[model samples]
Target chain A: MMSKFITLLPEELHASLQNKYNEGFIYLLDITAVDYSEYPQAKEEAYALVYIIRHKSFQEHILIKTYLHTLEIETVTDIFKGANWLEREVYDQYGITFLHHPNLRRILNHHQFVGHPLRKSYPITKGQLSYEVDDLIDEMNNRLLSKNVVCRLESGSFSECNKDLMFLNLGPSHPASHGTIRTYVALDGETVEAAVSEIGYLHRGFEKSCENHSYNQIVPYTDRLNYCSAISNNIAYVKTVEEMLGITLPLRAQAIRVMLLELSRIEDHVVCLAAVLVDMGGLTNYWYMYNPREDIYELLSKLTGARLTNSYMRVGGMTNDLYEGFEEDLKDVIKKVQYGVEETLSLIKHNRIFHDRTQNVGVINAQDALNASMTGPNLRASGVPFDMRKDTPYYGYENYTFDVIVGSVGDVYDRVMVRFGEIQESIKIIEQVMQNLPEGEVNIKDAAITLPHKEAVYNTIEGVMNHFKLTYEGVKVPAGEYYSSLEATNGELGFFIVSDGSGIPYKVKVKAPSFTAMSAYPDIIEGSQLADAILTLGSLNIIAGEMDR
Target chain B: MEINTQTLPLETAITTRLDDAIGWARESSLWPMIFGTACCAIEFMSAAASKYDISRFGAEVVRFSPRQADLLIVAGTITYKQAPILKQIYDQMSEPKWVISMGACACSGGFYDNYSTMQGIDEIIPVDLYVGGCPPRPEALLDALLSLQKDLRTHTYNPDRHKDFKGLLDDV
Candidate 1:
């Protein structure tokens, strides 16, 4: 079996993971904990610590299940640096303590937050009385003021150097950080001595909401995660649920999904690269990029009703077929995007200022990036040619011809360039898919899985009864757990679902790419200038929606 | 080329109160803070972009600093952790400011009525207008701004006026 459950003493975790690390499970994909207190079948353990790891060379992945009957479990941060925030997140949600974890505190919810909301026992509507706004600000300011760092002078005398290191809060509502991400940087003049990012400013408790919502009802919520590429998020989520149900999509549906995924990829990259340039004082490029993005949105609006939140994907297939004239509209959008990409390249490719601002700044070495469990373009830029699309070809990604773009000396410039290349590759993929469009039904005809047609529902008794059951109770997925991932616009967008043979998912854990990418921000910006820090953050493309959720 | 304004009667002149002039000036150039938290932020950007062109309504100058802005367009979902930060930003903005809660999330938490999201931004700060959509379209956001402009023109600066305007605060 690819996955195995091993019960080990709390102290044996470090040694066991060390053995696994040597065995080529070098990359840690995710570390999450699930509470099984309410489940009568799980009498041996109250919480399950789930660890997903991947081999560096073979691309083989394994799920390591370790059940914890006690509150405390060994911290894997020593073995994998990326486990720092992952452990904290698991702790924050499941209230399971990770022993010896560095800075093990709340990662998503506030430090003042009450009961772990991910626990089944926690009330969904239970609200906490947060500190007064003014008081919170005052307290934060006081804490910043009180933070003292001693620096040794040239004469070898230690002196209080807090005055030299100015602590600047760069977000929560800043133009440069894009969304509601706050990076507290201790600046030595313009150079950053240290940096720490505080997220959860956009945490809507998506997991908790998922537990309460039915299978299909959770589609809209998926749109909000990685809103730039809503279709990709939608497809990633539904694909996971579909996998658990062991459903196979039609060839046409798969082709359409690939098309949309590439389109979403182009959209995400355009926004990210444009926003990066804008942060570096290239306002003209924002217009150049967004103009095409607006056209894509128009096409998307025609395909689905909404422009931004296109919840287009269903469990078995898609919610609706491509609208009439969709091909022509899509062609027009592709042309526009191509024009925009060319124009953007001309404007910034040779610009000396752009190079000076981005090149060699916020460099994350390949080893550090791997240790941080970075994925997608960010990891690829660090000289790691690990694209999930290439590694584990899903949704017939193997049928498509594309290059896995990689860059050496990972920096802001390399990251931006990687995205630029990915955009071009996505356009190529989209054009290829359009040229060889498949013909068949978009959704599966299985009455038990997909909803019945309206005509059949109105005319036939069995159809009416089937539609009612599907609509009211939703699809009853067999009791099983599955982790499905896709090459999301940002990176490996994964959804880990635990089903209990019910219409509602027992546990829904979103392994958001931006979440992991954002965790490495402090490390990336440690020694860079304040302006370059902004540029690096922009290139990271850490969407607060995806990160916090 | 100077006209004989001294010869005209006081009533014949373009007579207006200082408050009316202030209201007109404030209404014309309402600088909104760029405070977008989620998907609605994208639509908000589109409104400010070349297509919808929010500059036509004199709200073109999108200020990143709260101290400089006069309007707070809360453009997406505001969570519990962000509520205090939003309140702080609102407090920082100069007085006689207006807020346009753009999108269903900011208006009433939209589909995410969970432990993290605030039920509505109005629970923390007073809102002058609420644009409705999971993420309202750019045109809806523009309409909200126009309506906010109308409110700014007619409404008095007195703090007590907000109490009478409570009916407008109903869920969109």
Candidate 2:
């Protein structure tokens, strides 16, 4: 039954929250934001007006939205500890400072990071710093700046900390940080006191760049966001545009998209699983996992032409039909994948060393996970059966019968098991798609949105002109706002597009799963030993591409 | 004494026998450090798997700690942020070590040209052999192994040419 309640609170408490918490109570889903660029007053008001959502059922959602003006926006941090990073992120990206935020240094960018990168007015070409190795040599030779030019960059009373607490900068160089993300971890002896993730080291202002490029051009940039699973990103972005345009993909096209997505998921998970094993010092598992992944890539290359950055999905449909020998090759690869998975499980999953390293490490409880807005395997490991595919039933996943795997103890070992179970489920999905392969047009005949056939483009005059125009000047969508979220190999990969009925998106905000998952580190690592932090990080599998983006 | 030099085929035979024994020792036990930096690093892992089975060549153990390794497979894109660390790891490895630069990015920074990437790993460290392709297939990496094995047969440590690329010769 649906329950509704209306209560009048004391004006003083309501006013304080409205000013401090932006809107005090988050009612609906976990969290959401509304762009106020249209209102001139929004720029000065210091509040972006956020909605906190609590989901009850499929279509039932409750929203709690309030407006708080400044850093006077006091920390709800006490109520939701996970908000520590999210508030910091909202501040870092939008320049919306939250009051009582303990440490609000730039999370995404470097210390020398010039400006707030996510502001709508931020220029794409201007204010970007370029560094080349050759340039470094030239600078050294010029003598305008000495090798050890001791500029007093920071001269302030910043030394107010416990003698027991030591600050450790873990990355922007370390192998395990994967990309350019650095963590400023404050440690009390061997246990972590507090840790903050620093991002924007690889920030290229992609969102701003999207405004300049056409919808088609934006696909290539999105590929670099989560380079490990480029296909999933491609699918998410296209799906958002499709929702806005109000177009339905053909049956064959849907199957093809699912096929490619599952393959990408397999490859992405294999690499991450391999990384964890490699970090734990059992190097052989890394070897066994990647062989089948390579075979999958071979299929990808044959089907999409490029392996990693395959911009295969078009707006209305896919770029091309499936290649002739794809099914036969896919069947062969599946056999190899089965063999590889078995070998990996036997070699490492049950091994004593593997268990000792991963078990009881980086534990997160169910309530804490929900409060933090955790999704994907990280949340699923904590006993939340919230798979986007199963929970929301997207992309024909409802047709296939698969279990939503969960672990009792939300630790590193559980995350591994959840992923392992998902891989088996993914294999089953691919097998079903192959068994029930349909016969029809792989791409739609929406000439306005999709490019013409190659034969028509080469042979006919109108087709030639249409092809050129579509390639350079992409088709525009009707003015509307749409959000699409998919269960990526990592987590909930979402795209929120704001269109102005132009070829370019007015504002495109990507809610990357890694960025959210990494935000919860401070909460997860609160009482754990320092060495356990690395183990916990590997379990989360936060790809810097997505996190920094 | 000059007339006697024309008569001995036995002396040449013994020299050839000694050379084969030395080559066998050099070919076996190539310990490669796990220097995987990107996607090609994934393929390097595959080369060590059961199906590809790199154990036949006696090079299966991908040492995590660099001090014990003799071969450095420079896999994936070598970014500017990553270059110095790569150099330090290369320096830490024992003497008589060789570098097999794997993939197009490691050979020459694949597609990223604007900034952030180093263009080529050879610009930073001396590469023994360069494997080409966006990310060369695992089988292609196996080919790199055979080529690195050939390099071990002829090249030896020389202090004079340590920093001098001008004096180096193509073994092929």
Candidate 3:
């Protein structure tokens, strides 16, 4: 296992966590809990709260686990501001209460939902519906009054207001947002006094669903994590499972996987850039961006079976080999994509309107961003050059020569420009993969992991038996636990898996990047203009499927 | 109140039933209120792209407001948390409106039938069409629009009340 687990007492969690943070563990990767009450190997403890922290310099992951006798523990929110939502999610799922945590409410499930749905005792099909909307009036009012700001934007003067602070609800079904995020902002004139966003509208019990499903069946569910870059989620899930099974896929599979990862990365960036631009009243960019994106979809539809959600990864390898003449088509698409990117660049690079709107719009200082545990391009946008591909070197990323794109101000402009820079670098990586494409069997030779051919199944009794056993029992993942992550579209989309020598996983907690992004949203949007807030939200690319999942 | 066909020029002259003319008008100039939440939203964007231009049907004007829109394309999964919002949006749309449930998830909750996800959105709101696929392709969305258009072309309207204008209450 990549992660070294350290058992801790509940009393020592706060002190030890502070000690580690002092010892250069600046990044908070994820906070999740495992319900081991029903597991065969578990001891007397009913709940185990796991905190995965990392060193600021590199990917030195440490898994600190503390078993809770009861459902209460000290909150680490004071140390890590991002722990607010992470703790709430843990509490919502496992019913492990965090003591002295401010505003510890249901983060993923509705407030009306009863019992922690992720508990082994909770029924999978028992669902509850909430009729009343949770207006975060108390929360937003405090944040607005506590700040006590006296001034406004640098160029504009702050006028004394006669009217009360106007509360505005922007989403949960607004046109500006992605239709899942709801933010209630207290506005003074056009400036936002305070804002509180809520998610979980699309929380379709992904973790609960993963527990009931076998390893292979869960691939399709991961496809919806960040549907724009679906394959990256697939790779993130399958890679963890593959590591647990100790299977080394052929070199050909690794090359193709990297290629698809870069391709999807481009696709994700294009969608983000185009959508944010359209928010700024530039619909022409959507045409330019989506044209190449649609061309990429054309190639992907041929590569995978589906257009949007391609569940193309198996345990040890890709579902199938790449079609012949794929390189020609891929190269052609890349050229067109580059041209489209250049057009958008010429239109946006020195444009006055875009610069004025995005330059200092939603600024989050590097310290606040790091405190909130932001990762990927968002972290990199704040001038942090930490990339999983570079730091961890998964899928032979170290072998490729490309820059880890960074930005200075960490505003909306930097965020958009960083994605544009990354799309170019991804093209470079894809071209490198195509140049030295490996030639070998995609799947590993292990009969236990790979499915047999149709001819073999009909002709041989061994094949029939093996297929049946693998179908019913699933690929036998040796009883163990591992946390593996990849550089997904948003951030470090990690899968923390616990297996118990059974067909189903004991627990598979997704460390979705967008969740962390949402945790940092109120901080980013506060004290900014409402119009700029909309642009900032779009620039953040808060995909609800991934955020809620 | 009939026009004189002999007085009108052949180029501009046309004759059709009022119901058929109303159906054609409703089908042609559809202002779609897109209720997209997940992957199908991305596909909807693809349909807005050049390869599969949805503007060709005169349905390009995607009004986020329920009051302005005539077609409701409910795309992606709607969980219990979002059920009330979906119902409110459905209720807000005016009469003579149509609903097209766009993906498997919207049609029957797709593969996610668990504690959080609803079995189908139809449990809360009536649907006119159900496009199938994990996220039915951009072309498939276009096909559903066309099918809905076909239904609207022959839909029997009753001015008296909503009772006579029977919807496509089939198991979509």
Candidate 4:
């Protein structure tokens, strides 16, 4: 289906959104701002707001575009609560203000940071004066005090009540928090009365960097996002570029890509499950799962050079063909992973303490979860069966037979169960791919896009010239914009690229799943105890690299 | 109750140096702070796991609190927003602390040479060891730990060492 872009005036945004909401576009996927100041065409406005909305029932998606002549624009947070962080992120990067946004503050950068980084004029390597802990703490205290959002506790004694009600800073360094998310949790006794999560500690300016790097150079950077499943990020990014280039993969390449993606899914699930179990005091479970994780890493290392940051995918294909004995090694490792999954299930699935800690904890209902634009196992755990692989088939995923695991109660337990079930399904998919592994060259034969084989480059002069040109000039993508997404282990990892017919992308908006999922933290952990909050956060599997990026 | 070394037989003396004994004791038990920031943290976890067990090196205890930790494995990227927290954690740790800048990001910002990432964590905190890799393998981290242990065993601590040492603030 073609995407219809409706350019509305700032005043007409609300009504347009209301109309779209009535037309089955109920879910707002992403909100990003693009600066078209330097472009030759599209000179009508300096900054354009791009919104990606999806229909759950009809499975139809559309891109809503509106130019902002002024810095201010109407907010859609009233219509979609998930727009809270997305709009803040847009404001933070582009200096575009949302008029009616409740907490219209910086989401991915320090409040003291000056100038919008995503603007075409902003330098990529410019560093700001770092804030001291005292400065940040004072700033937080001021914000809390001005908002008057602190809650009071009612104990027998006034002094006891006052002491019981206090703000506790959870992270930016705390181990329980998977990444560098600093949350200001106002606690009444042990219960979290209110929590406001502050991100951007690990923000490396990914979008800004994408503007500087060429199409191929950005592949390595994509590995840094959701490093747990670097291959998935690599594939998702390369797939987006390929879509813009109108390149199709060979059957062998497609099969290899499916295997790698499934392998990454298993690795990500194992880490998520093991981390959650460890946070809940199940240290043995962490050991049980890490063994298989290491094996998977070894398998990945055998295929690609690196283990964690496997920049394995190229523009039109992969970096290398599957190594000899890869299938045998994969079969052996899959068996070990299956055993590890079973062992973990037997250990924690029926354990009394595991249920006590996870069950009924961080219960986010289906409507709230969808409102937050939650994806991956987190969304499925909330009883919404939305898997991008099943919904939008890619890489010949429609040929595979697997179940989309769903949970009735979206609690910590449900999240863990869904991950466990997905891991099993991934193993099954990998097995199926191995049974029907295709035969052909991994990289496409396009001299302009794909790299020539090393043997050809060494032997032939023409091959040498092509390789030099491809490396130096990079793949020239046609001038266009495309939104490509894949069912990443976390959720829907989307890459929206606006190409100017040049090597470098004009705008690269990464709709990180962890970023959206972590936005729901405050709502999920509001009335939960501190211990339960930690467990729930662990269950969410918020990776700071992707969240901040 | 003790006999003089000169007067006692050569076989019975068995004398040992004080510095050697102290270094051995200190190097034998290096409690690392569990301060992992990004991808390298995963490799760090794998190093702590069963396969590539770090307990054998006497660096197994991954303490969450900065006060109790002696070694800071600065894994992953340290952004401008996180640089202060890293310094605060390093300052909170008691004296005789060591740091291992794991991964390319912590070593020299890796590929993220943008506004948010710090060029290297060494700019904020003094790193004793630097491990190179995008996210260095578990084996690389273990090697860094062993080398740090070797330095602790061999090098003598001098009060004047701090005088020649310069930090990122000097450039700032």
Candidate 5:
């Protein structure tokens, strides 16, 4: 449905990607593939790799498709550094070999995992064992050799290389890791000489689940992807499906979506800042942050039935109309959260210890951040003023008046500061949504797309069948593919859906933000102190549910 | 029934069966090691935070290391890749420990019955209690701890014996 859907041969995949990068299409949005082996419609090619790249401002967007004869293709990591993880993931799922890929082993699955699960030929429920810890020492030694630092590890000998330098496991269960990521760091006294981050501990096969589930059933899955802000993920998933269907939602539904979206963004920022502050040893600010999140959660629980995973967004529109006096509750919570944030942050924002731990410790410039495909608050903190809401302008975001907040320094402090500013701007957008509240039915007018009312269901056979089919099978989307992204809490939360003119999607590739952000961890953490590395990871806000999905 | 014999632990002298006294002591101060891996982690924090206040029930000393913890609260989804680590943690915990499998995923892989996901965390490590929800609410998690506490109140001391439980496939 988007522009520039050109097909290329595997031989030209590398060169074409290079040519695009040379022409200022530097922002590599995503690299995903669909296994056509299992599509309902017969296809010539077994697989088609889709590349989404954009210029700096995201004005001239390009989505290229390349068919593969075999499960082998040239790796594009040289042109786009962000292609490293994306390529590895493709290799992991589709078993497509990325030639010259730096570390192209299993990423989402353990090495013990046998077959590529994403391929249609592969069985869905064939479980595997997850033994064997990853070998990060070889890579650590390689980096140390490049640095000319004395390599403590000599032929796998644990001969007390140096008392000062040691290997430490920072997570997967540690307090600072927020219980998900495992960072293996070779430490030189207090400084980290090399680090290798191992994720996928929470890879619960979210995309594979999408392959079997209906469009509506996947909403709860999206909520788990970014649990901090469930609605944003919900919006991204539904927006992609709605785009494929070519349906325009009612004005009131759009307004309500924007309202919940901004509220979710504020909640996400609050949680990220709270966790980051906790990592920085500012424990008091956590309650200050969490209290506001609880308020938002309470508000959402009333609107939707669930708290953390609110499956509130239907494909065509919202599930329910806004309750009466909802506007008053929204405004009151916004005021309370704003005041709470300002009052609590003021205590530690200017504190010397906080500044010392965060400032200039994990510095990343704009170019490097963009090259790594970072987005949202982290990329903005690196001084890029790119926002999907402003540039792509989805769901009537253009009408809202809010600045794209940027920071000069790309460190923990700047990331925190950017989140703080963005929270205020989100509040501003929510206020705007309140001002432009239109009165109308929330669900669309079409009966086939949306379920009929209870009264209608009880009275007519058509309504009864409609309710039954719609409830169980979900709305059928046309046979086409669309890549839709939105500015989620962490970054660009993208969903690339390949529909087969049925309820079940052919392939759903989530270009999750935390995955890319966490991929850039080793690059920025090597030269920093051990303490700063923890703060840097927390600042990135790598939700394992999203990253490992 | 008296839970603690005295305000100061050293000066306490109480007459009771070894099992009853030890069980009361174990249930009263359950040091929980949270193996949090997904959305359920957030709920665990809420339960641990100011609102739910998990410390009120004595399982609030959140420890990451298994050796120091008396209870293993497996709080989220345990995938195939993460199952070994979960088993290692469960194996490394101090003796007389209990495992509270939290969330639907931890109990039975929830909605994701896929290639990479373990059918349930109990497939790798034995479980004492299972709480069900996509992500069980904070209250549900608290109630799980309380329910585990009721079970813990009858724990008998055994130096050479472990819980008589085995996984479906424990080799991994």
Candidate 6:
């Protein structure tokens, strides 16, 4: 077993990485940008800090460092191939350049985009569309604000002069391309020679929105990131903040977090598997798998007030105790979903179309899979025995026993099989948690951060004041940086947050596994037919919100 | 299987100019372009499935290419980057087309307060009807379709309709 390293660093450490750090292997987890206008002179410089984690043996952990300047850093793509997309993301969100990186164009936005929308300096509200020719003239003369960047058209498509390659934009609107994100593929007919994924067609800059709101106020925003599994997002954010505050949730709260995360895993995998089935031309299986998924959503909604972005987990604990009759409702939902899962498995597990479509298509050998930095089902499909929940337990995951499912053939079918196996495993995990339900306070009794009882607030004036202050101003996290990762529905969802001991976080950066998995799309689509391309894309289950964030 | 007399007679020929117009309309039972942008797109998927069964109204075949489609179902949020693509799709579609701006985000940007999201998709393209709800239920999406069909039956194919609807949200 490799020792997990969690090193906290000051600004001087940034210079050390630039000058002397040469690794056995280095992986840039994610970068978080912070506004420093209000901080003291020592910390008053706007910076983007990235967590560089090293992977070894069965366990993987990382060290942290903060960078003061947005100067172009040496591309880590040459070192740890996984850093390619992470560096591009830093460029996209913070306008920080990463030198010596190939294909450094915008990954999330259009090429001719004006501003880095994720930066705090950018205005939050939408501006009026200025059509006056005179306004353009004034801007050209440097007499007025630049209106061109607000609502502008980006020109230039791929050139036809290059006979060797052609560019195809895959579905900002196309059926196979789920939602609004598009992948610009440079191809020689069916073979994708190279690819650039253009995201931010759905970029809402969720990180920037978190700055204006308080800690508790930002749970809804996390919901939109990976809307397929909002519970995972909630867990990541709350856990990271919990680390910063040194707040330990009660036993019941930890168990509830585990239960919710497992259910979310089941739902996320079901939809992904069903969608992949449809992509492979097995519609009957798609509909069959989806029926049980509907039941899961119903169960989720009954437990929490909202279904998708449950906001169930709070900083210290949950929004409220589980809704009454949740146990009975959950049991029925579990029973029906189990039946639905078996029916779905039988429908497509032996089907000819599914086998033919997925077996040999988009094969990624284990070495290439590691090189491309694939994770979750995709990496497991390539026969990598890695699962965050099993390997590195968080939020009571280690207490439950389950297999870390792996596959031999790293194709679409193997990925499906991994998710299918994991869904059964998730059910096993949830079942255990339900039966061995821990008896304790649902939330920490600390009233300073969380609100006191409604009765207490109504009767006592201090309780009322505590509630108001916590709601409006939010809880102040201690000044420090904390890194935490949870086994999200997709893969490892990590949060690297830097707190300035303020109500609002200095920076909260999300490490979305789907986004990293999406970086390999161009590689997966190479030499495949157009329809196969759709199958691989859907099978990957790349979420645009997470990708573009 | 015996055919019901209540079912309309099947016509094989679509040769004449008049027949082409009527036949296209019959085919146009309004083919909805899958404009699924986010979570609401899930409900849109359920609507197209066997249970809700959108094929009952003869509008189930979703065309991947916009050139073949006449109906655009705006299923979720229209972000700033997504706005241009949505407009381009609407522009590529044939005339006498209808758009169902489904869900709150497509209608008015929903809970999004960021600069990246467009307030309403109608600012970029014309919408025939708006379906409300976080994700409007399948029944709501079906209602939008019925409403669009009603409007389509009343109005003939008009070239001027495109120009009138272009950049439509001036006063509203």
The candidate, 1 or 3, that scores higher on DockQ is 3
- Name model 4 segments beyond 4 Å from true: A1-4, A133-163, B1-14, B164-172
TM per candidate: 0.93, 0.75, 0.95, 0.94, 0.95, 0.85
Interface RMSD for all numbered candidates: 4.0, 7.4, 3.6, 1.7, 1.5, 4.6
**Candidate 1, residues B1-172: lDDT per residue as tens digits?**
1248889886775658787778788878888897899998988888877888899999999999999998899989988888777877887987777888988888898888788888888887888788999899999988888887776678767655456442212332
Order the candidate numbers by TM-score, best to worst: 5, 3, 4, 1, 6, 2
Most accurate candidate by DockQ: 5
CAPRI rating of model 3: medium
Worst 10 residues of 4 chain A by lDDT: A152-161
Mind giving the per-residue lDDT tens digits that candidate 4 earns over A1-549? 123577788779988898888877878899998899998686678988999988976265788888888999889998888999999999999999999787787878777689999999898999885656423444444444543543223652223224456778898889888878888887878987677888998898888999978899999999999999999999999999998888789999999999989999999999999999999889999988999998988888888988888999999998888988998999999999989988988998789999899889999999898889888999999999999878888888899999999999999999999999999899889888989989998888898899888899999999899989888878989887778789999998989999888878889999999988999998899888999999999999998888999
| TM-score of the second chain for every model | 0.83, 0.79, 0.84, 0.87, 0.86, 0.79
Colliding pairs, model 3: none
Model 3 scores a C-alpha lDDT of 0.87
Residue runs of model 3 more than 4 Å from their true location after superposition: A149-163, B1-16, B158-172
Per-residue lDDT of model 5, residues B47-115, tens digit only: 987888899999889888899998898888888888777887888986777888999989988888888
Of 1 and 2, the candidate ranking higher by lDDT: 1
What does candidate 4's lDDT look like per residue over B19-127, in tens digits? 8777888888999997888988998999999999999999998898999999898888888878878888987998788888999999998888888889998777777
How good is the docking of model 4, by CAPRI class? medium
Tens digits of per-residue lDDT, candidate 6, A1-549, equal 111333334435444544323543333455544555545445634664555563634376565545455455556566556667777777776777767786465556555467776676767764333121111122221211121112232563222343465556676777677776566655567775544455566766677677677898888778778878888888888888887787888889999889888888888888888788777667887777777777776777777755555777788888777777888888887887788789888887788877888887778877667666677788888898778887877777878888999999888888888888988898898899999888878888876678788997899999899888888778888776677877787777877766777788766778888777877776677667767778888878887777766
* Worst-scoring 10-residue span by lDDT in model 6 chain B: B12-21
lDDT (C-alpha) at residue A324 in model 1: 86
Instruction: Kindly list the per-residue Cα lDDT of model 5 for residues A1-549, writing each as its tens digit.
Output: 433487888898789888888888999989988899768888869898999998976766788998888888889898889999899888889888999887777788887777898989888898887576676777666666666565445586443345367889987778889657988988878989878888888888888989889898888888998888889899999988888888888888998998888899898888888888888777888888888788888888898988899989988887798887888989889987998798777977788998888889798899999999998889999999989888889889999999999999898889989999989999999999999888888888776688899998999998899899987887888888888888888888988889888888888989899888988989899888998898998898888888998
Clashes in model 4: which pairs?
Answer: none
Candidate 2: stretches off by over 4 Å: A1-83, A119-175, A178-196, A200-205, A348-353, A529-531, B1-172
Instruction: Report DockQ per prediction, comma-separated.
Output: 0.47, 0.11, 0.54, 0.64, 0.68, 0.30
